[model samples]
Target: MARIRLTLLVREDWRDRYPAVLERCRQAGLVIERELAAVGAIAGSIDEGQLLALEAIEGISAIEPERLNTGLE
Candidate 1:
């Protein structure tokens, strides 16, 4: 499947283990583009097929498609 950009929300309780969580995300096939440890957010791209794998990770609270603002709004 083609890769799609995504935004992951890290659970508040998992903030302390952000690095490890990030590693797990990488192992799950996320090509990390940006990490906002303070807000517990991670932005990356991953195979559409692997999305479920990422969602299965315990530390991740949510997974959303990356949104693009065309400036028309």
Candidate 2:
């Protein structure tokens, strides 16, 4: 059960690497939930341990927990 959801920010300068990043995520055991084109981000879930390895991937700007915003944060 891939219950952990995360959002990955793709660096604007590295948009071309999106495909590679997606593959890396899958290799890390993350089930890609969605891809936000306008924001250059990707959402997915994986085991907690697999996430740490993603930091080694170039072009990934940020990895954050996914949440719905109602403007109250």
Please, what are the lDDT tens digits per residue for candidate 1 over residues 44-71? 9999999988989989999999788999
Clashing pairs in 1: none
lDDT of each: 0.95, 0.80
Worst 10 residues of 1 by lDDT: 64-73
Leading candidate by lDDT = 1
Best by TM-score: 1
Query: So what's the TM-score on candidate 1?
Result: 0.91
Q: Compared with the true structure, what per-residue lDDT tens digits does model 2 show for residues 2-32?
A: 3678888988988877888778777877788
Q: Number of backbone collisions per candidate, in order?
A: 0, 0
TM-score of every model versus the real structure: 0.91, 0.77
